[model samples]
Each structure stands twice: as C-alpha cells, then as structure tokens.
Target: MFQDNLTDLLENVQNGALSITDAVSRLKTLPFEDLGYAKVDHHRSIRNGFPEVIYCEGKTTDQIRGIFLVLMRSENNILATRASSENFAGVRQIAPNAVYYQQARCIVVNPVKKNQDANHYIAVVTAGTSDIPVAEEAAVTAETFGNHVERIYDVGVAGLHRLLAQLDRLRKADVVIVVAGMEGALASVVGGLVEHPVLAVPTSVGYGASLHGIAALLTMLNSCASGISVVNIDNGFGAAYSASLIIKEIMNGCQE
Candidate 1:
C-alpha cells in the first residue's frame, strides 16, 4: 500500500462505506512498527516511492523475520539484500512465496510488476565471469524496483573486442551499471562509449595488489571518463540504487 492506497482509504472514510474502527484496524501499520530491536519503516514507500529493504548481513535470523513480517503488512514489494540461505529460511517461514537469488545473496517478496510503459532500460555489464555475482546483485535489485535491466557479462578490458561487440546495446540504455574487479578499467571503457549515466561497482575479486577491491575502487574513483559514478567496493546494491534513481528521474521526465 502506497500513494494510491492512502488516497483510496481516505475516500472510503469520506464515503462512509467503511466504519472508523475497521479503517483504523487496516491503518495500524501505517507509520511504522516497533519490535524492541528494530522499527520497521512501513511508510518508506510513501516517502521514497519504494518500501524499506532488509539487509541481512549481521542481523539475526529472527530479527530479519520480524522486520519482514512488519513490512509485509504494507503489502508492497520487499527486498532483502546481502541475505544468506539462513536468512531466506527465516523469511520463507513467514512468506512462502519469497524467492532467493543465491548469486546476488538477495531475496524478493511480492515483487512489483514492471511498468510496461517504461521508456528506457538499464544495462548491467560485468568485466568477467567472476564478477557476475556482483552484477547479479545490481541486476536483481534493479528488477526488484521495477526497472528493465539488460545484462552483458564477461566483457573485460583484457578483451576489448568483447566490450565493443556490445556497444550498440549499451548505447541504447538510459543507465549503465559496469561491475568489475582487478583494475576496474571496464567502467571507464563503458563510460566513454555510453552517452548516459554509468554507475560503477568494484567487486572484491582480484589478486594481491587489488587490496580486496580497494585497488579497483580507487581506479574507478580516478576514472577519466565523463558521466561516470562509482560506488563502494563490492557494493552492487549501491550501484543499483543509484541507477534506479537515475532511471526513475529519466522516466518521470519523459512522462512530462
């Protein structure tokens, strides 16, 4: 439940079709719910245009389940990033429909259907096969938020021909997410070729000098290409969120 639901609820109140007590029962979960350890923000959908997402990294399984149940009250799409199989089990006990993407380490419950009228799509490109996990994180996150995502994998700078082969498809995207490790040169290469915004994600998939992706992060930060934005090391979710925001703004602008 979001903007439209709120509007409909108010209309029902005004029309006297629903009793005040009954409406109150449905509205109890409006602002948020406090569960000792966490306060689930159900109203985030109204404010951010999307519901609050669960990050199941350090939290206990029970905590994740509690939050998941609270968010489910809103009946909106729910995303849990950095989730493990154990985390999925906790959520699944409550929401049997929850689907988990192992490569992404993310879970989606009640995913919203994409808007078929969307005018543009986002491209998720990875430098190597090893970087596919990070790329999947970005791809799945974008899809969860109801954006069209095109994935191009194993196109590192080591083989510039591979990247060039996908240039035409990359050029058509409204937003491009380049996921890479090692030197992280793929972001710069893709950024130079695309006219749209390019969000870079540096994964922790490299050798000694890579410094657990710090080297790749620095390389992306120092990229020479224009229209390029870099997120944290191994932060696929950040890249997806940034790309989603850019795509949303572009779509909103097109509608106007």
Candidate 2:
C-alpha cells in the first residue's frame, strides 16, 4: 500500500491532475485510521520499519477480526502475539492465509520476505527442554520479522559440556536470546561466552521456591556478564523484539 500510494502521488504530479497540497493532505491521513474502538497507527511502518503488531490476549474475537481486516487491506505481512487457537479461528475468517504456531502461541499473516541474512542470524538458546516454548516464541517472532533464527535448545548450566560444545554456533550470531527458569544462570553463562548482545528471558517454569520466575528474573538482572540484559518474566516476545532491532541495525550497518 505504501508503494501504491507513492506511485499514485508521483503519477498525479506528472499528469498535473493533483496539486502538491492535495497530495500532502492524503499522506497526512495515511499515518493513521480511526476505527472508534481502536485508533490504529499506520505510520508505525514509516517510523519503526514494521507495521503495528496485534496483541490478541485481552481483545474479543470480533474486535481482533475487525483490526485484522483493516490492516490486511494495506500491508502484506501481519503478526499477532499471545493468541489462542480460537483467536486464530477468528482471524482466519478475514485472512485465510494466516498460520498459527502452537508452541509459539503466535499468529502470522503473509509472512515477510526473507533477506540475504539467513547466515548472519539471531540465536535463541534455552536452558532446559521445559523452556522451549518460550524459546520458540522468541524464535518465531524473530523469523516473522524477516530475521533468520537458529535455535539451541537444552544447553543449560546443569550440563556444562553441552553448552561448551555449541560455542562456535553461539559466537556466530548477530544477537542472542536466552530463555531460562529456576536459577537463570544460563544467561550469564552465554553472555560470558558470546561477543554479541544477550537478551535474557526469565520463564515461569520452575517450582514454588523459584517464586514463579522472580528468582530467575532477579538473577538475570544481576548478571555478572557485562553484555547481558534482562526482559520481563516469561516475556519471550519482548526479548525477540529487542533482538530484531539489534539485528536490523547490524544489517543496516553492513549494507552501508
């Protein structure tokens, strides 16, 4: 839609059919659409380089469908996080091409085109098998944004050798996202090993003594490793979004 609008504006100017003031007026309204219930920000793509993401957890099925239809009319790609199968069913009524990733709990419509950065990817590492769901959420989020993602699962501190063996792969990433529960020591460990930025995600995967991830969250916040940074508890989506920004900057730098 952005391309279409630009083409139309340039053609009208060449044909002398519309003045510059009229073009500016149309472009001004392109920034946003007021749906009464929700004021959708279409300018996000111009500002942030990505369209607005739909967070489907609190919204009703009808509301989600309405927003989805609005965005679908303009963009080729769309993403919805923390969505259930029922929410996906609602979205499919408007976007039949939508796909639901069960483990990631994410829905994607018309996934973005991949770039040449598949080899220069983001790495998502998990401390244990139980943390894979959160890890998968991070992985899918990164992939949907057109970043290639490599997943390294079950390499927690419990087995030092398993993590050590994957050092070569971890070092190759542009950025890393570590998902762990319990002690959350995996983030510090990976941070110490990799030269890239590490985004730690604390999951609510531990027992009562783990305080439903508070212990792990605090441990990550106090990481001894210099490059380690922490996101909110069980917030795989947030971690991935940060990683995507870093990856985009790195790629842009390389292109320059």
Q: Tell me, by TM-score, which candidate is best.
A: 2
| Local accuracy of candidate 2 as per-residue lDDT tens digits, 1-256 | 5557767887997899989888766665563666778777776766677778888888998888888888887776688888899999988987888999999999999866777476789999999999998998899888888888989999999998999999999999989999999989999999999899999999998999899999999999998899998999989989988999898888888889
Per-residue CA lDDT of model 1 for 1-256, tens digit only, reads 3556667878899999888887776665564566889877766665566678898888999999988887787665689999999999888999998999999999998767878444488899999999999999999999998898899999999999999999888999999999999999999999889899999999899999999999989999999999988999888888988888888898788779
- Candidate 1 stretches with Cα past 4 Å from truth are 1-31, 117-119
Give TM-scores for every candidate, taking all chains together and pairing residue i with residue i.
Answer: 0.87, 0.88
Could you tell me how far off, in angstroms, the CA of residue 208 lies in candidate 2 after the best superposition?
Answer: 0.6
**Backbone clashes, candidate 1:** 0
Evaluate residue 176 in candidate 2 and report its C-alpha lDDT on the 0 to 100 scale.
Answer: 91
- Give each model's whole-structure lDDT: 0.87, 0.88
Q: Lowest summed lDDT over 10 consecutive residues: which window, candidate 2?
A: 24-33
Clashes of each: 0, 0
Candidate 2 Cα errors over 4 Å, as ranges: 1-31
Provide the lDDT at 185 for model 1. 94
